[model samples]
Every structure is written in structure tokens, then in C-alpha cells.
Target: MGNINKRGSKDLVVDSDQSQQDSPTITVDNQLCDAIIKEDCSTIKALLRSHPVNQPLTILTSYRLLFEQQTCTVIPIHLAAEYCKPRSLLCLLEHGADPEVRDTQGHTTLHLMLLHWPIVSSTWTKPGNRIQRLMADIQNNAVSCLHILFQHGAQVNAQVGNSNKYSPLHLAITYGTHPILSLLAQNGAQVNAVNESSMTPLHMAADILNENMIKTLIACGANVNCVIPHNGNTALKLAVCTASSKAGQLLSAGVGCIRLLLIHGAHVNAQDHEGQTALHEACCGGREAIINLLLEFEANVNILTKNGESAIYMYLQRSSNIRDLMVLTRLLYCSYPLRLTNRQGVLPAGIMLPEFQLLKETLVRLARKPLPLEDICKKNIRNIYGKKYKYYVRQLLPGKLWNSIYNCYDLADVLKGDL
Candidate 1:
């Protein structure tokens, strides 16, 4: 038999030597790698002394080996910048290890420095010493490190590559590091830059409920209604979806931003790709304050989502408290009639089930008057459900409802035909 055997129709040949030569070599030396990984200064210094000449490949290989394995305890640089000896980091830098090299997660040395700086310094609190001094060192150093990376031509907008798809700006906003955000923006980092999920720095600020960050991003020209690439959600929509007290604070800061967007020509009634408007988000988030703001901007109440859900529907679905339900009920009354249906043709009254029934009964009582047949019957009915309904209406409306009712009554002659 030959080295090559005959196949069904043709002879086959194999080159073992060629195949062996084609295989990839590990390239990086294991001993230097282990020394870096262990952060064994003696071992690393000895290796450097033995090598005599600095090589980029050798330095990078050692640096990466330690970083990849996370032997930060020994390799102090892998520890927070504060905990790590400056000399070791300087040594690595001198040996041509890229100061801006990121880890497996794309978090650069600067990113690790910002996050871990605080952690390392948390252990060094002194009673008489102002804590600000310690924080100042970390902050100033973090700024300097960022400058170093920027000078070295590191990517200013590199994404973190996870659920947030966040860039450095996203991290700054999330961490409430406004100064860092400003530096990144000044250095050409995208202000409205979105993450993998299509969320902007403004959106992240909203997520963290950082009011000042929201203002900063808006001031820097972040698009207020910049939609998520995946679902077309806007920064405002995300804020409204978060119903915490922190969410409220962010919404207040964002109120001016929303107004700016409107004045600059954001579509008040513009729906997402799914046909949901900002109104839906405000309602679904149960944020009456934001809802009122959307209304002021003339958001369309009648807009329906692809699934045939309207803002009122979402509001009703999300209403967990009496106040929330009451606010939504009032808004619904001000909008289309409860009989107005969505794309599915399901009316508000039909969709809310038991809640709708109770509300309907209340409305009927509120609207009812004694038939002209008898004053006594009218008074009795007033004494029954009518009085309580009026009281409730008074609480909701004060002078407003009565004024509206007077207007309606005065216009009744013209509306009589429709009635």
C-alpha cells in the first residue's frame, strides 16, 4: 500500500510534515507568563535582567498572561491602582506593556482603575483626615490615566460587550462620574452613544437616577428621543418605565430636556417601531408627573401599540395604588370616552373588567339626575349615591370640573342634536 490510498474515484494524498508546520505556536513564553501572573516582582525583575533587551512581544505576552489569569493579588496592577505598587506598573510601562490594554472584558486599565480605586482606598479612612483628600487622589489619577490612554490612541468609545453594550461614557454615567463623562465627551466620546441594547448615556443616567447626569447629557446634545436600535425606545420612555422615587428625580431633570427636544422638533406623538408612544411609557411606569408632562407636549392619547394596547390600557394595567388609579381615571376621562376602543376594538370599560364596572357605576351616578317626574325622588337619589359621587368629584376636580360642566351645559343647545 502506498502512503496515499486510492479513494472511490481518485487517489488521496496526505502531507504530515505540512500539517504539523501549519499548526499555530503558543508564541508566548510560559515562565515569564507565570511570573507576571503571580506578580512575583523578584521573578519578573530577574527575567528582565536575564533578557537584557526589551521586546514588545515578550512584554505583551507576559502582561496578557497575568491579566488573562487575574492573578492581581500578586500582580498588584491587577489589583486596584491604589493597592498596586506604582513601581511595578511603571516597570511594566517601561518594558513596553501597553498601559491601555483591556482585559478579556474590554475594560481597559483605566476602567479597572476607576472602579477599583475607590475599593482599595476604602480601607484607608482616617478620622481626622478629610475623606475628600483620599478620593481626590484617585479621581485625579483616574483623570491622568484616561489622558494617557487618549494620548496613546486608545478607543474612546469602545463598548463593554455585554447586556449594556455600554461604552466608557455609559460607565461614567452609570457610576455618576460626571467629570469623567465630561473628559470623555471633550475627547470625542459620543454623548448620545448607545450600548448594545441601544441605550444612550442619558438612558444610563436615568437607570441610575442621576439627575445631574441627565442634565449634563442633555446639555451635551444627547437626543432626547434617540430610540434604542433593538426596540425603538427613547430615553424618556426608559425613564417613565422606572417608577422609583429616584426615577421621579431623573424625570424632573429630564423635564427640561423633554421641553428642549420638543422645541427642537421631537415628535410628540411619534411611536416606536412597536407603535408605542412616550405616553405609553409614562402611563405604564405609573408616573403621573411624567404623564402630565407628556400631555403638555401634546402626546397623542389615542395612539395604540401594535398589540392594540393604548396608554390608558397600560396605565390601568400598571395602576397599583388608589392614587395611581385615580390619576389615570381622570386622564382617561379627559381623553377619549371610556367607550373609545383600541385597534382590537376593546373599549376601556371592556378591558378593565371589574375595575371598569366599578368605575362605570360611579360615572353613571355622577352623571345622573332625578327624572322630571318628582323632586323628592331626585333628592332621595342625591341623598344616596349622588352626594358621595359629587364629593369624590369635588375632591378630584375642585373648581375645574364644575367650570367644565357649566361650559358643557351652556353648549348643550348645539350638542342636543348629537345627543
Candidate 2:
């Protein structure tokens, strides 16, 4: 194949040795595209070098490529990235192939690299050796391609994609590319860059309950309390919402992420657009561990949503399991107000079904009997000190006094009901 020349206003022709009758003239763009699909590094290099300086290379015309019977518009670099052909990608980049060039959908080569990575799901019953090897190769090539692009002065924080305008860091977090996330952060990728949905990389990590990614983002200076612009939902809110449907391994990881966020100063009582806090979301999830964690952080159980629904009210409406009932019991012991009414004028106690007769009776009794004065004082003290009270108390008090307060068995005993 030789240089591309305009045969007519509408057609591009590639000069070749074969006669026109023997091998009909093919479009020059098609010739280069075929080389890209086949990963012909030598052919690509020849075409780039021998192409006329005045004409320049219109490689963008060959954006569309067929993969697994699906047609997607992709530049040569993106195609190379997808196929894990690092040699071809580097050759194209050296030849002026823009690493920042976006496809029709505004996705850069970096976005395609993360998007096409082979994700091995837990549900796969049997992954053959070929599949495993293929996955490993893909991962290796992806890392190499990323490094090459960065070295070539690719914008680390360039937001691509038509829908969300996601930065490379966002894609890394979304695709579970742990190493890539770290690389991007270390290379000056904006840790707090919000996507089209106002979600930062931290929000994405928290949404998936990825503890390691969360830690990485936080260490890179992610704002722990940064709320999504539209929903005003923080990373803590996203974590609680995600933990609801997760189970077993994912649930444990979710719990850990929440704990990590809280320890890093995530506000427990931060409300969303509807005035619902992390406690409200946890209650809606009906997970005992999450609810207990938020309660221990002193999430105001009596806090109301825009609709006047409290956390306990939402819990009652969403969950009916015995475990959830026990969670409600714990909330009651924590002094969640029993007399709160929602916007619809429905009280939490009045809506209790007959199956929860014991709970209903207990709530009635608690409503009539005043909480212990000492317990009320302790609750107030905790509220004043905030969740990091223990650390402050330790720093302010002597070891013996601190131990005495820390080992307050009566406080623990009162919180733990005999039932």
C-alpha cells in the first residue's frame, strides 16, 4: 500500500502495485484502519512516515472499528489500547496520534482502556486458563499504556465522555483499577474533580464500598464532606445506601468503608436535599451493624426529613425482619423520640403491625416512663463532644481517670437491654 490520494471529491484512493482489475483501489482510510485492527505496527509506521506532509494524516476518518460484532467509533490509539497493543499505541502516539483525541462519544483513549478491561466477577463458575491469561495480559498492557500517555503529557484531569465527563481517575475508581487510581492521584489527577453528576472519585469509591480506594482518595486530599451538587449526598450517605443490598463479603467491605469515612471525619449528621442524614439511610437499609455504628457516632435519631419522617420512622416503613426489629429496639434504648409524627400525621407507634405487638407494648411503656436522668446527661455530653469525644477525653484527662471513664460498665450495661 502507498500514500492516500483523492481520486474524486467523495472518495479516497490508496496507490498499490496490483492492477486496478486485479485489486480494485481501496480507500486510504480503510487501509490504515485495517492495519490498526490487525495491530500492524510496521504498516502503521510506514503509512505515518511516507504520508504526504501537505496532505497530513486524516486518521480520524477510520474511527469506527468492529469488535466482537459490535461497532464502536474509536481512534487508532483507542483501538490499540482496547486490544492491549502497547507497541502500536506508542508508535501512533509518536506519529502525532493524539492521546487526548476523543471518539464520537467524547471518550479518550484512557477512558476506553479502563472501560474495556476484563472484569472477573465472583459469579463465574469456572474461568479457563486462557481467560485468566487474557485478563492478566489486558491488565499489564493497560498499565503500560497509561504510563506512556502520562509520559507523553496527556492531561491527567481531562474530563471525557459525553454523559458524565468523567476524569480518568473517575473511570479508574468505577472499573476497580486500584493501581491506576493511585497512579492518577500521584500524577496530579484532581482528587476532588466532580463529574457531570457532581460525583467525585471519592463518591464513586464510597458508592461501591471500596475501602482501599476510599483510603487512597482521602489520603490524596479528597473532601470527606463534599456533597454531590444535585442531591447533596455525601460519601457517607452513598456508603450507607450502597451497604443496604450488599451481603457477605461486600457487606463487610461496605461496613469497613463506612467506618473508615467516619474515622476520617465524615459528618454523621450531614443531611441531603431532603434533610435525611447517614443515620436515615442506614435505618432505611435496616442493617444492625450500620445502624449501631451511626448510633454510636451519635446520629440524631430524632432528626427529621423534609417530609417530617425520622430515621426510626423510615426503618419501620422499610424493614419488618426480626433482626430489624432488634435494631429498632436498640434505637429505642438510645432514646429515639417515641412521640415524633411524620408530615402525614402518622406516628411511628400507631403504624406498628400486630406481629410487632411486643415492640409496640414496649414502646408504649417507654413513652410513659421517663428515661434515667444519668443516661440523658450522658447522651447530652456525647452530643456536645461530638463523635471524636473519646480522643479529646483521652488527651485532656490522666490515664487513670481516662480508664475510669472508658471502662464505665454502667453506661454499657444501660445501653445493652436484658432482652
Model 2 lDDT at residue 111: 74
Where is model 2 more than 4 Å wrong at Cα? 1-40, 50-74, 118-134, 246-253, 318-326, 349-351, 368-375, 378-419
Q: Give the clashing residue pairs of candidate 1, or none.
A: 165-196
Question: Which candidate should be chosen as best, given lDDT against the real structure?
Answer: 2
TM-scores of all candidate predictions against the true structure: 0.59, 0.74
Q: Report the C-alpha lDDT of model 2 over 1-419, residue by residue, as the tens digit.
A: 11122111112222333222232222344456567656788888776665431232343222123211212233567667666677778888888877777776777777777766545444445545676655655656667877888888788888886788899888888764566777888888999998999999999999888888899888889999999988899999999888875462353648889899999999999999999999888877677788878877768887889999887777766434333345655555445355445788775643366655555555457666776776565555545553447678678878875564344454335434422
In model 2, which residue pairs have backbone atoms overlapping below 3 Å? none
Over all chains combined, what TM-score does candidate 1 have?
Answer: 0.59
RMSD in Å for all candidates: 15.0, 8.1
lDDT of 1 by residue, 61-141 (tens): 113334332111112233323232344455555555554555555566555554443322334444235555655554555
Identify the candidate with maximal TM-score.
2
Off by over 4 Å in 1: 1-95, 117-130, 161-165, 244-267, 318-330, 337-340, 345-358, 361-419
